[model samples]
Target: MSRGLLFRLVAIVVVSLVFPLAFTAYGLYSGARVERLALEERERQMQRVLGEVSAGLREINSGGKNGDALDREVRGVLNRTLAGYPGIRGGVFLPETQRTVIGGELKWYDYRPEVWPKEGRELFRERDPVIREALDTGEAVTRRIVMYRGEGLVHALPVTVGGEKAVAWAEEVLQPAIGQDRVLRKWAFLLTTMGFLVALASALYISGSLGRGVNRIKNGLEQLKRDLSYRLPPMPGELGQIVAAINQLAQGLMEKERLEEQLQRSARLAALGHLTAGVAHEMRNPLGIIRGTAQIMAQEYNHVPGLAEDVAVILEQADRQNRVIRELLDFARPAPPLMQEINLNAILESVLSFSRKFLEQNQVNLVTQLSPDLPQVQADGEKIKQVFLNLLLNAVEAMPTGGTITIETLATPDGVAVSFGDTGPGISPEARSHLFDPFYTTKSDGTGLGLAICHQIVTMHGGNIEVETGDRGSVFRVSLPRSPERRDAGGTLDPGD
Candidate 1:
C-alpha cells in the first residue's frame, strides 16, 4: 500500500470515529443547556404567577373584603394569574385566616394522592421552610421540585395583608426533560451513523482510486520488463505524468538496445570487411594466375586427349573464385551513392523486365501492384535497382519448385512503401536473427552479401527495411523517403555493405 493511501484511510477512519463522537458530545451538552434554559424559563413563569397572586391578595386586603367575598376574590385572583402563564400549573394562597386557596391546571393532582407525593401535598397544605422563609422575611423564594409525574419549579412570595404575613406561591410543572434527552440521543445516533457511513464510503473511494493508479503503474512496469515494446495507456493528473515518464524510460531503453545491437553489428561488419579486404587482395592474383595458366594449358594442350575437360574445370572454378572475391571487395568498400531523384516504379519495371526470363525458367509467378502516383525517391538509381533485383532473385530462388512473388508499392505518411512478398518457406527464427550479419547464409553456394547490400543501399537513402516471415510466406517491406529533403532531415546515415 502506498503511504498516501494508507494515510488517507487512517484519516478517514479517524474522522469516522471522531466526528460522530464529537457530534454526540455536542448534542449531550446542548441538551443539558436546553434543559437548563427551559427550567429557568419555568422559574420565571412561576415568579410571574407569584407576582400576580401577591398583587391580588394586596388588593383584596386593601378593599377590606372578608368572609366568602374575600375567599372568592382571592380564588379568582389565583385562577386569573395561573391562567395567564400556561407553565404555572398550580397556585396556592395561605391567608391570615389559615384557609388555603388553590387554583390552576394541576389542582386535580393535589386531590389524586396516588400520583402526587405526600411530602409535596404536605408542603402545599402546611407552611414549609421555603414558604416560611418568604413569609418571615417578606421576600420571594424559589425551589426546584421533582415528583412522580415530572419536574417543576416553585416560587413563594410574602404578601402583607394590612401588615399581616401571608404566603403567595406558584408551581410551574415542566414537561419531562428525559423525553428531550431521548430525542437528542435519537438525533445524535442518526447524525453519527450518517456521518460515519459517508466517511467510510469516501475513504473507500479515495483509497481505491489511489490503489488503482499505483497498480496501473506497477502493471505497466511489469509489462515493459517482459516486452520493451509495451506502451502505457493515457492517464490523468500526476499519474498521467508518471505514466508518461515510464513510457519515455521504456522508449529510451528500447532505443538504447537497438543502438547497442547496431553498434555490435557495425563492429562485426568492420572487422569482416578488414579481413575480407586482405584475403580478397591475396587471392585475386593467385586466382587470375590460375585462370591464365589454365587458358595457356588449354591452348597448349588443345590436341592433348582428355585435357580439355580438366582445363574447363580449372577455368570454371577460377571464375567462381573471382566472383566470390569481387563480392567480398564490394562488401569491403562500397562506393558512395550518387544521389538523384528517380522514379521507383520505372526502375522496378526495368528490373522485372530483366528477371522475366529467369523467373519464367524457374516457374515462378511474378505479380506487381505498382502504385500509379508513386513519388520519386532521392537515392542512387543503380543501388536501388540492385536492391530490387537482389530481393526478386531471393524470392525466385526461395520458391524452387514454383511460387508467387508479390511486389506492391504504395504511398506512406513519411515516405513510400515497397513490399516484396514471396510464397516460400519462411526464414527460420535462428537464421532470421543474424540474416543481415556478414557472411551469414542459408545456401551452400551463397555469398550472403545480397541482402546485406540491399540493407546498405536502403540505409544510405535514409530509409528503413523490415522483414516479416511466417509459415505462409515472407514480406520484405522497404520504406524510402519521399524526397532529398525528407532524407536529409533524418540526420546522418549508417555506413554499410
Candidate 2:
C-alpha cells in the first residue's frame, strides 16, 4: 500500500477508537470536577440557610427567649424544606438559643429528649474542613457526612435574639456530589471520539493520495498498450523514476519497430530487385529477336496482303514491353531532378492538355480559373508536370461518369498557390492519410509512387502540397514560395513533357 493510503486507513481506525474513548475519559474527569464544585456550593448554601434560621430565632428568643407563633412557623419551614429535599437529614431549629448542629445527637428522639450530648456541634462527625470552620465561628457549618443514610452535605447557621444573645440554629442536608460526575463522563467520551475521528480521517486521506498515484501509473500503462504512439504523463516522486524507466522501455520498443520496418523494406526491395533483374535479362533477348523479325517482315511483306499490319502489332507489343522495363528502371534508379524557375500555371495547363483527351474520351468537362498573374516558382518543371498530369489523370479516371475538373490558382505575398478540384468522388480518408506513402495506392495496377514522388519534388522546390476532400470531391492546394528577386502578380508560360 502507498504511504498516503496507509496513513489514511490507520487514521480512520485510530480516530474511530480514540475519539469516543478519550471523550468518555475526559467526560468522566470533568463530571467529577463539576460534581465536587456542586457539592461545595450545596454546603455553602446550607450554611447560609442555617445562619438565616439561627439569626431569626436569636432576634426573638435570645437568652432563652421564645414565642409560640415563631415555633409554629419554624416547624413549618423545616417541614417544607425536609419534604422538598429528600436527601436532607433533619435537625432541631430553635428561636431561643443560637446553635446550629449539622450532624449531631438529637435533643429528643421518639418524642422525648434522648441521647443528648454536650457541645453537640463538635460531637457530630466532621466531613469537610469548611464546615468545621463555620462551626468554630458560631456562624454556620457546611459539611458532608454519611450519618444516617447515604453520603450528604450539612448546612447550618446560628441565630440570635434581641441585641446580644444566641437564639437558635437552622440546619439542612444536601444531596451528594456524584450526579454531576456523569455529565463529565459523557463529555470526555465525546471529545475522545472527535479526536480519534480526526486522526483516522488524516490517515485515510494520506492513503488515498498514495492510491491515486498508483492508479495513474496503471492507467498510463493501459493507454500505452492501446496506443504505442501515446506518451505517458510524468509521474510524481519515486514513481517518476518508474515512469522514466517505462518511457525508456517505450523508446526501446519504438527503435525496435523502426528496425523491423527497415528490415522488412530491405527484404522486399531485395526480392523485387532480384526478380526484376532476372526478368529484364530474360526478356531482352526475346525483345531483340522480335524487333529484328518485325523489321524483316515489314520490309519483305510490304507488298504482301496485310502481313505488314501484323508485323506492326508484333513490334508495338515488343516496344511496349521494353517501355515497361524502362519504367521499372526509372523507378529503381530515377534521374536527379533539375530545378528551375517554372510557372505553375503553364505546368497545370500542360497536364490539363495531356488529360484533356482522356477527359474528352470520358465525356468529362474541364474548367480553368488560373490566376491571371502568377509568379514563377523554383522547381523541377518535369517533375512538377508529372505531378500535375498524374493528379489530373487520376481525377479524370475517378469520374467514369461525366464530371468537371476545375483548376484554380491564387498568388500571395508568401507563396504561389495552385488548386486542383475535381467533381469526382472525394478521396477516401483511409487512403488519403497515406497518399504520399510509397506503395500505398487505391488503384489496382498502380505502382503507388506517384503521389510520393510528387511530395518529394514539391518539398525539393521549397514548397508544400495539401489536400482536402469530402463529399464535394477532392482539392489539392500547392503552395510554392515566390522567388526572391523575380516577382509577378501572376502570368503565363509554356510547359512541356
Candidate 3:
C-alpha cells in the first residue's frame, strides 16, 4: 500500500511531537529519581547523627551527672557532633520536663534571639508525634518536612538517660537540594518548550512546501484540461518527477490527437484524389479541343479587331483551364520522387538564383543563412528544388509591400532543416488549421494546390514541414532525414502541418 501526502505529513507531525514529549518525560522522571536518592541518603546521615547524640547522652548520664551539668554535657556532645555538618541542628527533648536543648552555632536565630524559645516550641510540637513514636517503640524514626527556610530531613532516636525516657533528634536543612530541584525544573521546562517550538516550525515548513507542490500540480492539471499544450514546470524531489511524467503524458496526448487528425485528412484526400482523377481525365479531351479551336479562330480573325481580341481572350482562358487540369491530375496521383543523395544547400542556392528576378520585382529582400556543414539528404533534387521554390514564392506573395524573407539551413541530429521566415500579416488560426488542405486558398485567384502539393511531396520524401506564426510573421520549416534507409529504420521526424 502507498501512503498519500496527507498520511505522510500526519506521520511526520506525530513523530515530531512524540519524540520531544517522550524526552521531556524521561528527563523529569530521571530528575525525580535522583532527588529521591539524595533525600534518602540525607535521611540516613541524619539518623546516624541522632544515634551518636543519644549515645553521648547515655554516657554523660552514666557519669552521675544531673540537672544543669547533665544538660551541659548533652549540649557539648550535640555541638561537637553537628559542627562538622553545615545546615544541621541537633537537640535533646525531655518528655517529663517538657524541655528542649538545641546545639550547634545556633545561626538560625541570627535575626531574632527572643523568638528562639517560641520557634523551638513550635518545632517540637510539629515533631511531637515522631518523638513519641520513637520513645514508645524504642526505635529510630525519620521524616521529611518543610520548615520556614525550605525542605529538610529530621530523625529521632529514643534512649534512657538517668532512668528517664528521652528523644534525641537532628535536622539538616535541604535548601541547596531544593534550589537545585527548582533550577532543574526551570531548565526542563525551557528545553521542552524549545523542542515543541522546533517541532512545530519543522511541521509547518514541511506542510507549506507540500501544499505548494500539490497546488502547482493542481493548477497545472486545470490548465491542461483547458489546453492540451499546457505543461507543468520543473520542480524538485518526488514532485519534480511527477511533473516530468505529467508533461510527457501531455505531449503524448497532443501527438496522438495530431496523428488522428492526420489520418482523417489522409483518408479524405485519398477519396478526393480518386474523384479528381476521374474528373480531370474526363475534361482533358474537351479542354484540348476547345483550346485548338480557339487557336485557329485567333489566327483566322487576326484582321478583325473585336473578333481577334475575343479569340485571344478565349485562348487565354483555355490555357488557364488546361493548366488547372494538369495541376489537378498531378495532385490526384503524385509521381514518386526519384530519390538520390543531394546537397540541400545547393538546391536552395539554385532556386534563389532562379527566383531572383521575381523576388526583386515584388520588392522582396532575400536573406540566406545556409549552413556550410549541412549534411546531404536522400531525396529527389528536382522535387526538393520545387519545394524550396514554392516556399520562396509563397513568402514573396505574403508580403506584397516590401519585406524581408530570411532563409536559414541548419544540421539536425538525424538530418537537415531549412526554415523560411517571412515578415507578413501572419496567418490566422482559422486559416492555419486547413492551410494544406486541397482546394483551400485565401487568395481569389489561387487554386490552393501549391501548399497541398508541397505537403504531398515532403511526406513522400519521408520528411515533414511545420509552420510557426505570430504577430511578427511566419516561419515554415522543412526537415528531411539523412537517408531513406534511416527514415525507414525507425527514424522519426518532428510533427508539423
Best by lDDT: 3
Error of 1 at 117 (Å): 34
What are the runs in model 2 whose C-alpha is more than 4 Å off? 1-195, 203-213, 233-252, 284-324, 337-443, 448-497
Candidate 3 residue lDDT tens string, 366-418: 89899999988999998888788878878888998979999999999989999
Candidate 1 lDDT over residue span 50-154, tens digit each: 777777767765366565566667677877877777656554445566655667775554423345677657545443566677777877888766644665567
Write candidate 2's Cα lDDT for 1-497 as tens digits. Answer: 47656865895687568655865776677766877787777666555555444544444432353454444444544454445443444444332343332212242332112343533333344433443454457665555555444455555444443444332333334443363346456665666666676766766775777687788888888988865555778867887898888888988896787557545544554455556546766787889998998899799778988988899899887887787666444444445557678888888777776677778989888888988788777777887787787677777767878788888888978878887788878877567656765567777767676665566456546666778787878888778786433321111111111
How does candidate 3 fare on TM-score? 0.63
Candidate 1 backbone overlaps, count:
0
* TM-score for predicted model 2 compared with the true structure: 0.43
Off by over 4 Å in 1: 1-188, 259-267, 285-322, 352-371, 392-408, 412-414, 420-433, 442-446, 466-476, 483-497
For residue 181, what is the lDDT in candidate 3? Answer: 78
**Candidate 1 clashing pairs, residues 3+ apart or interchain:** none
**By TM-score, who's the top model here?**
3
lDDT of 2: 0.61
TM-score of each: 0.56, 0.43, 0.63
